[model samples]
Target: MSGTSDLEFFNTQLRSFVPPGGFDAHAHLYRREDAVDALPRHVEDESGQVGWTAYSRALERWMGDRRPIDGLFFTVPKPALDRPAANRFVAQEVRPLAGSRMLLMIHPDDDPADIEAAAMSSPCVGLKVYHVYASRADTFNAAPGEFLPEWAWELAHEHGWLIMLHLVRVRALADPVNHDYVREHCRRYPNARLLLAHAGRGFCGQHTVEGIEALRGLDNVYFDTAGICESEPLKAILRTFGTRRLLFGTDFSVSEERGRCVSVADGFLWLSEHNVDWELSEFGRPTLIGIESLLALKQACRSARLIDADVERIVCCNARQLLGLRQAATNQTQVTYRRAKRLIPGGTQLLSKRPEMYAPDRWPAYFAEAQGCEVIDLDGHRYCDMTTSGIGSCLLGYADPDVNAAVIRRVELGSMCTLNSPDEKELAEVLIELHPWAEQVRFCRTGGESMAVAVRIARAHTGRDRIAFCGYHGWSDWYLAANLSDS
Candidate 1:
């Protein structure tokens, strides 16, 4: 009863089933002692009592509705002592993932050697650490600094282990120092791939852009969606880094939040399309929407994350590249042309977006072939060609013999040349004749070229070698010199 875009379609499965051995390295599993104490705080008053049985029942119901969520991460509910306690807790909650399914968590100060030994003794498909919890606990990190055991890196790196750290932007933690620690950890174990949970946790900002920028060079870093509610900061992060470095994470633990986890994720569904608006999304679970909505949502994601290639950098390539995971080589290329890039950089990028952020991704396809004033798309879609050959491009109708002849003549005459064509001189003459006051006519084919030429001209005319630009004005000194120039 649910469409592809409907959260119910996905959540229904999540409620009924778990992913086949999929692993979530960032969930929390408190001891019964702790669950009894903590579950009450988060359990929705409407979901019934908050006890281990109730929590377990709710979780099982969700899992049974959804099953085998690859694996769910369960952080230690504090009050853990020594490796034995942590190991015992894992045995009770996470050790179920013996062969392939895994749910792993590592406290910052937990001895990595014990964790390694436990992995050897049992199966731990993935590992997680909680910075968000730490923040709530009033600590800058979930565990002490350099939380990874000395040998943890060596062991995890050697085994191609997938490590997850709940690294939030807890105002105080996202720093050069913390980034350095992570980078150093990565450097120590070259094969170590780490996913930073919550895309570095910007809930209320214990940090700033400067903090995120601090880790610019660390290629091994990754971000997964959790509590992220906005696409703008995510867009900036994707742009600052790359969309490939991003992973789709829904901290589904928010089932206790005001809206069901499905509702929250539904709010994010618009992020999947090219013409959606989150404001338009249905905010509830156990309810079905439609496929058109889903397609629209994903369409937006395809672009919002890419406009500046930031989306591509974050959502698709970066995580796989850094983690050494391979994606299904997509035959489809989300190539945004020069015009789109001029505005949206990677073409209006965001991790979660509305379809409108990416409609350009499907231009002619969304509309059928243009016939004079009309055009249509594959889905029996239709639209008006408002500008029929208005730009003299034979576009959207107006293709006549005269236009054809003119185009053929230009082509045959070789109007485009490696060097400046005589056509340029003739065109300049016509322009100058028309204006009379104009002194120069610059011939550039594309926006990028024109922009570069314009900058060069301005710099020459003003005798000021320095300049500034904000958007995707490539080929300009302001852009090229951004990382190099004295500016």
Candidate 2:
């Protein structure tokens, strides 16, 4: 099933990266008879069937020591395929495989009665809806509602079942219509767990990166690292949703294929031995798509600074929890820190406050409450004032009685309004009186903004564009310009 190069690549590049046992969140299992026509060239099984045995054998060939113990299995969703027979094949194949589950394939127009019967009779965990079932010829551009009808949502909601949606459109998740549909449907059917496959079909990483913001805070929503071969989309998903919501997957059959999807221009393109001349390439021959996907995931985990436990959750624990199976324990602080690295650049707003500046993984990266000189972390561990004290901003020792009373009084009187407060004039008078040489004062919100304003005033008054000063004044453009080579 795999050549010597595949074995070498697995040992050197993917062995340590992949954990002991994984759960493939996305995969297919069916026979040739299930399809209306010949199967795609990517299906490499000579026996004309790809059941649990075939899948296991394929993994053994390339995975070496690490392979998925279970998978979320489904059948090929061709428009003209025999739906009943295909589903029966899937049900039979996965029934005896403990911890493995199957999703019933359905079209928009399918009879709900029949679907209900199949669900009750078999161990079907959810539904697998595809675009090919749409009425239009160009199903790639079909909307989610076109193929996945409202009835499906109702059924899923009523049963609390999951829906593995492979979003398809020109821009995928980046499209506003897709965003609106996902947001509305998710809100409407709160009980139906929506698993966005392929990181919301993020073959083009930009689509996911640009559109992931809209789906944030939707607890029912989740993502699977399926056939995606790039780290950008995975990193974006990890940043938005922690490791618990990001399930590891191998889009098998396709994963067995030798190729990778690359982002090209506004869309994505697939490169395979059939489409390109591997012999003429400067690099070595292409490995399995599965291998490429694993490498990309490892890179994303490294970039996001995910711990071993975080990686374990993505590869094994998350899927188990989603499937109503037992899950491994995880630390909340580590989970939050991983998310912060993805959301906040350098993992913190100020470099001095970064966890790496303290103890990295061992450091408590967040706080639940603060009072006086003591702070309580998420796990309720208390620490007294010993270090920078909130980067010197908390010299008053956090939530001081006088400061708290003054803040409360100001807030009660309305801290902000359409009209300027008379307090500004009084503050200006006090500042000018403190420094007799100053005639007036300009107020700004932060140190960086104040620095920028000061630089502008100095340039305008002196009629000179350049000035020399040192020692990290602020993050203003003028101050940061010192970092440039020509400066």
Candidate 3:
């Protein structure tokens, strides 16, 4: 009854990609009485309620066989809605669904004690504060602190609960105010997990891309792929945060709706059946918003070079970890390797270090920290260096104390300047002293660039382009040309 015409679309486009036993990180649960205003037509159920059963049935219609194992449920945070009733409804509905969790819809004016009492009474895992709860009529432009009071942050920090924030402001994360708020608050409340809904409300895509840098090192922050119909923002998230930090969310009832939000100049516009004439389009027709979101996610994952395991993390494992639910143990090294293959050509910058060059999937392709001859991997396992020893570059061993001290001193004093550093001249003089036959010296950052320069100088001096070369000199075209018979 649900998927109907879209069943073909789902089967053809998403059936294989949509892994089973996944979790929905974001979804809504409530009844008619919870809202003072009428519910959206798509979510209006004949049973006078839209709980787990209704949600499952609706999901079955559209998703077919690829149903989520459980979901993080919340209620519509309309300005005039009865908040207590909504929370009660969600709590009652999800009590039987194992692994399903709910959040208490909180207003800025609500008492912290009541909020805490509600959380204690119910199985609510966190707080869901909305922009509509702000005191201003134009809540869209409301500052973060106006709707989400400091007490909520303090309470969440103390209890280690999550705060699902749907960011506002015309430019979303691109706005300096929004960026500062997220950075400062997240840093201040280290224990509270801040789940940014809709990928930082990245309807414009550019907003998320531009502002994602500000949130780079904030480990407590995370994002949800809920109702975003574009790939750019999702790609930006995956690239910046990697697979573990990005969670899959349907935005549920909104996902069931027929229109989507598209980026316009500087802002975004929601194109729904009510706003646009579908008959006038040259394209066939609009699919469900949820379907469009999945398509965008699929495209982003493909573009980001995510493997199946990476997809599983986004769709299922990440949420389980966030919710404290038990999940299958994953090898962090292998996971990082799979991600590397997708993001990096040959899974590494150096051909010698490629995972395929050694033990393949079993190789430790990355390290979290390195000291002397021992290296620590992402999973916290340590190893002794029996191989290249930092590809022979770190002959002094990784993080040698003398080298680190010099680098740190230079960095602290400002490593770069508009003018050349005197250290360059001193280093060149030292090199010249080492080789008495050479009076002048030039420097290049890498061996490849230096080899190219050397080739250019030799060719210029002798007026000859051809020369005999041997074994693994560099990546310069001059060195690579040996493979070509014509060359």
Candidate 4:
């Protein structure tokens, strides 16, 4: 239903939102010009047509706003193609785009040391295992671990590299043997983090959910939403993985043609020595249906009610985190914090609560809820309050039941009205009774404000321009004035 190069249409659809610094987890870029000569007689004619410039234009169009995007670049796997040459092309080509990472295809027979040497010599961040291609099968139906070498895992574990895995067999999760094989392999190579392509290629939502559940306890396992556009499945992935393990991918090139009508002359579908047409012919007729990957993804996200935060995480945060690109992956929180520093003086209301007081770069400075010495952070992770319970204000502990109940009762009776509540006066009298020297008292919401009031009273009573105080007196103009002149 979509036109070729429908940039304008995509722009209109995405006008309301733009995820800044988003990463395309799955994308392709390579020099195919030389590969044409090496390809088989039948399909060799099809090679060398798509160049990097055309690829760049397509990326610009996909990016929509002409703003560059980061991606994990790869070369499409083919039998006759020189794998090392492809890796060299991607590494050299993507050097300018420092945000992008490269993943090269690794076969079982490839020497691990040579692969490692090549990786070290290039800008590669990981390896991709094309199960179907490596197995020399028309479709992915064999167990991945059955063919993958242990040396690949050892190298990845040593260097902390990612393995962009595409599993074989449609019912991978349902098949216990396949699931256990992968589970055991992951356990053996704990450091070689794996990201499943196309949500393990589960076409249906329930199957996708089941497949994700299969790798439930594997902390290093990840997934990407590329050719998958089903809303229910997207929702299931988001719900199960929490956006941290789900990466955003368009599967580029392939996604560019997705869901678009293609003529018989298209090299990908028509010209192939491997029974290209007959093998793909559905029973009797020659028909082709495109998968509108990008459009469908946007629609799925909208349908799933995923907010900007989740979208940003999937499109940017997760990839950056996985790649250990902390400097490059500017998340929504960092963006907001940067803006706040420019707009808000000192960046926050309370100096102590400023991001610097905690992990600074890593700490989540915002909270959603606080109850009984526990805090739920902005990202929904809860933590126990072991540190000084709100600067020691909560002497009875945070959110004490008795204290909350009294406050609730007072609110129910009437927190404020034409006259002050008797409780304030009773408390003042009680304080005086407890300490005879304390004749008067004032109730203020914060210690800092109370300290400012006290400073003003001291200045007024003593009729002095300077006053001396010991210890930290909080952030108040009165205290700040003392430091106006050099001691």
Candidate 5:
């Protein structure tokens, strides 16, 4: 899928990174070098952490799915014109398109107009303030539990701004001591909605195990899935806060953290491999890669799914809605890579048949289910299906009937039991008879599994973990062993 078709596929269904239910309200990005440092007159550390152009250079190189970046939450640390500089950098240089990329935090200590200027400056959707670590300005302070007053909160709230506040360690959402301020602001200006940075780190931090009951009914409160919390902690926060109130964030410069590292392990490599494979297919070079990381990323998403599709949607949507950027771009070829990513490791799941190498438009042949294989592509062409189904195991068709029927029979017969199914014996006999070279036979499922099992048999027979093959083989020592235990 490419162009508007690709964008449509991504926005509607093809883009799988978005959480299925709500949205990831918070996502931060590092501005490696000021995008617009036209005048280096005022450059400093507290201004902003910088990294990668809009392409997600470092991020995609790590997470495997940099293509879905909709927004970046960041703050102009300190500088006379840092905000203006950064905005110009992003708007004119980094991502000059219909899509949006933004930074929402306010450096309250600076002139307050910069705060409103920040809002009106770019296409940002909200405002963020870490009054303690980032700001700590006395004026924005609200009260006991309140840092920013009701009137101040209302100032940003009236414009439909989603506020992000870092309430250092205040965990109990309802704890009067910590929450009296929030109550005051919510009552005085119920409209000033706030997303607690670390989900009241100290209050609920120790008792995350205490769960949903602690903050069951707070409608205006929100939390970002980041900081001392990640993975399971993130899911818990989502549950306690609900998908609507939970957003996705990596706490800026913290992408080096374990969670960030793990998130990109597969996705980053996928993009790396996809780019290389593409060049290889066109120019005959290759991205030497194994499936472990890709499989790991899949497993990560899979584990999250156990909670509910909504969790996934929230993570994805939060980024999109916050930035107002569509997932798939009208002119991007990358969506093709994202679409075929699920089933294949590095988009192939095969040792040789690298599908990622082809252009997005060229992927139809590899897929057996193109809407029209003959005379339907407008140019009146026919395609010969080329995807090797599980290393030559998919002869009947992709999701074929006869093959599925036989497997279904054995599966229902209890393939794993005290006694093997009669069908297994019959199939083994037929295979041995078919190939006189097969003096011994073993039962296994999946081409990868079968090939690995065959290698084990070969080792037993010839005392070797080595073998040579003629065609595309999966997980057959030369393939599966490539993943190794390290994977």
Candidate 6:
């Protein structure tokens, strides 16, 4: 049965987040009778269908109390089904809408001239190409010729049509063949624009971002945010392309996370519900990702320090520009502290140095350079060392000339290697000599780790588990774990 969860969720929960006239860059409208006749009976959602009639009703339902959205609708062609029939269905049913646009589906074997005539007749803005079909779902990888064939490119290049390419290589856009094909084709035929579907359909961490980066310097290439809800990938797309080249898409009529058949409305709700930084561990820290997944993109933009203008461009302006409607122009401080906040949760290794604990808004979150007792910000603003220098780590003050020189000399002599440096033993001996009572000394990476090691050694020596501390110490699970039961 068709799911109403999508319709209800969007109208009530997600409706508020969607911007007015926001364009859905990726969407589909296909005929049900054609699917029933051409496709095998094994496919789900085949008999119980939502044709253009149902889709129209759902669109109205989706806009119940929210502003209307403009959609770039395409005909999802079932292979072996009549291409002309599907194109005619989309043109007849979807093209009449106020702000809707259409893309014609072109098969590899179809005659380019005939398809061009059909496209011109329907007046589609672009052409859709799918390498993987439901009938041969098992065969995912396809050679360049087998997928679209050289003739398809010739037609698109000749007509200067936008090719909505859903590539099917193993690594998707990251695949060498796929990358080479897209870069070469886009470069060779500057008139033909390639819109990589689902951020090149690379769902893995940083794979999509890195893949897009590999095809850099091509002005004809662009990407869409359809079916993508991951925080990292979205941030990467925004940061790399600067929201100008990223068109807002939801891969409607399909699941955002999976390619399996699903309700069109579910795709919208899925992205909204799963909006969050999913990479973060929820073991001990408070959840950083918000519950309202629909609001995730807006929040992510804010987290990335993107201004409102850029966010607007990403959600609506970019899509408008792609459709030749409208456009906007292209649009941090913090050294270690600022960077660590974005890349590493909790920012600093120790919680004591967290800027939030201090004057977060006014705190100088990062430093460009430091020498002696002076600190310089990225803006070249200089200040004298006043507060605890580096949270009390720099006892002799930052960049002490004599101390830095000695450290540099040791580094030149190999600071760390498989064989221990002479300084390790010398430092231990010096510590022992200074304490006199202590028989040996050990080194650790952080004060917290060293404290935990000391506690472990003490517990092992006494054969006891329970221990007491007087006042404040470092942050270690041994001490903080007890605080878990305090409240």
| Best of the candidates, TM-score | 3
All candidates: CA RMSD in angstroms? Answer: 18.7, 14.9, 11.6, 12.9, 21.3, 17.4
- Structural RMSD, model 4: 12.9
**Against the true structure, what is each candidate's TM-score?**
0.47, 0.69, 0.72, 0.59, 0.43, 0.54
Question: 1-487, model 3: which lDDT tens digit per residue?
Answer: 1358777789889988889988999998888766434345556578778889888888888788787879999998787788998899999998898889999999988999999999998878899999998988899998899899999999999999999999998899999999899999999999999999999999999999999878976768999999999999998887666677799999988888788889998998888877898889788476788998999999999987688988988998888888787554568989978988899888788899886777878778888657667676776455788899888889998877589779878987999999999998999999999999997898998887887788789889998777677778755555546445673
| Per-residue accuracy of model 1 over 210-268 as CA lDDT, tens digit each | 46666654545666655455443355454455444566443534432322112232122
Of candidate 3, the 10-residue stretch with the lowest lDDT total is 35-44
lDDT, model 5 = 0.45
Q: Report the C-alpha lDDT of model 6 over 129-187, residue by residue, as the tens digit.
A: 77654235554677444566677677767877778887665666667888888888888
Candidates, ranked, lDDT: 3, 2, 4, 6, 1, 5
Worst 10 residues of 2 by lDDT: 35-44
Decoy 1 TM-score against native = 0.47
Please give the range of 10 consecutive residues that has the lowest summed lDDT in model 6. 284-293
Q: Candidate 2: where are CA atoms >4 Å away?
A: 35-47, 327-487
What shift in Å separates residue 107 of candidate 2 from its native position after superposition?
Answer: 0.6
Error of 5 at 325 (Å): 6.5
State the TM-score for model 6.
Answer: 0.54
lDDT (10s digit) by residue, model 5, range 180-237: 5655555555555666664443223333424334444444566665443224445455
Winner by lDDT:
3
Candidate 1 lDDT for residue 278: 42
Note the Cα lDDT for every prediction shown: 0.47, 0.84, 0.86, 0.66, 0.45, 0.62
Candidate 4, lDDT over the whole model: 0.66
Better of 1 and 3 by TM-score: 3
lDDT of 4 by residue, 290-409 (tens): 134445556667755678876777777778778977543335455567788898887887777687887776765665446566665654455777776776788676656588679778
Q: Quote the lDDT for 269 in model 6.
A: 24
